[model samples]
Target: MIGIIDYGMGNLFSVSKALERIGVPYIISDSPEELNKTKGVILPGVGAFKDAMARLQEKELDQFIHQYVDSGRPLLGICLGMQLLFEESEENGRFQGLGLLKGRIVRIPDRDQNGERLKVPHMGWNKLHFHQEAPVLHDIQDGYVYFVHSYYADGIDEQALLASAEYGVQVPAVVGQGNVSGMQFHPEKSSATGMQLLTNFAKAMERSEELL
Candidate 1:
């Protein structure tokens, strides 16, 4: 079964629904034992980084998550959950993050060298463009997906970025490295395009297990 870590402050319903629709066996739980038994884990959230971290810590799932990451099992983080995979975020007074990935979160640049107004919270339907080809993106077409965030990860290693979207500036839409993956957009709400993304992730998890 796939494990959805329900620490607190997650878009739990939509994410759970997406997994169900994809016919993936899954459970949402804060229990470390249940989480450890799962074939793969997903961290989904639609809230502040600080608050989510607090809930994970309170539930004592933080260390478990770290151990799982080191196990080389796939662990996907969605939206704000993706931000928490990093070292720190500047969302509210330089709050620290999970440091699962080597990076820091910061606000997107509003102006390019050309000096144009780039809006924050880059919401609405935007195209997902792959940074470089990877198996996780297999059969995944470049299409529109929903986004609802003001800040995006910056100065991250280019190798970790999987896809980007235009929002006055190129925004990181999908990110992955080794066994960890993330999405800045809400794949659960993006309809066929979104469902396809989740399905793709499910397939990726399945493939990882076969190799083991």
Candidate 2:
């Protein structure tokens, strides 16, 4: 089973529904103890970085995540949840993140290098370009995925970058380091490409279980 952290800010319904559609059993809760029992965890969010971090801290799940990752359990973050995995975010002033990965979150450029006005909240489908292989990306090819965000991950280490999408900037689309991973796009809403990602993640978790 997978534990979906419900810290009062995530798109819990959509994420849970996606998991169910993929036939991946999951439990939604705020308790780390309950989450720790699962083989994998998913952190899904859709809101401000500061607010989300405050909620996670209030539940003490922030520390729980660290402990869980230290045990080598897979943890995937979606959208805003992805940003929280980094060191900090400039979404609304400088706020500390979970620091599970090397990077910071910054707003998408509103203007291009040529001084052309670009759209913010890069909302729509974008093609993914794979940089490295990851278990969750197995059997997945370069395809379009749904993206809707105003900020993107920056200053990321090359080793942790799995995939990226082009907006005004080269947005970090899919990133992972060992058991920790994140997706800037909403796989639950990305059609075939999205479903494949969810399916791949479930399969990866199952494979890990079988090894034990």
Candidate 3:
């Protein structure tokens, strides 16, 4: 079973429904103890970075997350949840993050290199461009996924970059390193491509269990 970390700021409804459609067992909870029992954990969020970190610290879920990843289990962050995996974000001002992955989150450029005006938030579907291999991306091909955020990750090491999308700038879309991975898109709402990614994650979790 998968544990969807509910730190009072997750898109719990959509995420849970998506998992259900794929037949992946999941439980939602704010208690780290309850979540710790699951085979894998998913950190999903839909709010401000500063506020999200504050909540995680309040519940000590931040420490729980670090411990969980250190145990060799899998952890996947989605959307704002994905950004929280980084070291810091410049959303409302510089603020520390979970630091599970290297890099920082910043606002998408208002203009491309050509200085042409570009849209902020970047809401809608964008095609994914794969960079490296990952279990979560197993058998996954380049396809469109739903994205709805203004900030994107930057300065990420090449090894951790799994995929990206062009949106006035090269936005880090899918990122992973070892037992941890993240997606900037809403896979649950992203049609067949999204479902495939989640299914792949489930398969990866099963493999991790086997190793234990």
| Highest lDDT against the true fold, candidate | 3
Query: Of 1 and 3, which scores higher on lDDT?
Result: 3
The 10-residue segment of model 1 with minimum total lDDT is 134-143
The whole-model lDDT of each prediction reads 0.85, 0.92, 0.94
Q: What ranges in model 1 sit over 4 Å off?
A: 110-114
Winner by TM-score? 3
Q: For model 3, how does the per-residue alpha-carbon lDDT over 1-212 read when each residue is reduced to its tens digit?
A: 99999999988999999999999999998898999899999999998999999999999999999999998899999999999999999999999999999999999989999999998889999999988778888777758999999999999989999999999889999999998999999999999999999999988998998987
Number of backbone collisions per candidate:
2, 0, 0
TM-score of 2: 0.97
* Window of ten residues with lowest summed lDDT in model 2: 203-212
- Residue 180 in model 1: shift from native, Å? 0.4
Q: Give all candidate RMSDs, comma-separated.
A: 1.5, 1.1, 0.8
Q: Which prediction has more favorable TM-score, 1 or 3?
A: 3
Q: Which stretches of candidate 3 lie over 4 Å from their true place?
A: none
What tens-digit string does per-residue lDDT give for candidate 1 at 1-212?
78999987897999999989989989999999989998789999887777888898999888998999888789989999888888889877788788877788888777765888777778789888878887667777658899998878876779999899877666778888898888998989999888888888888888888977
Q: lDDT by residue for model 2 over 89-162, one digit each (tens)?
A: 99879999999999999999999778989888899999999999888888777589999999999999999999
Off by over 4 Å in 2: 210-212
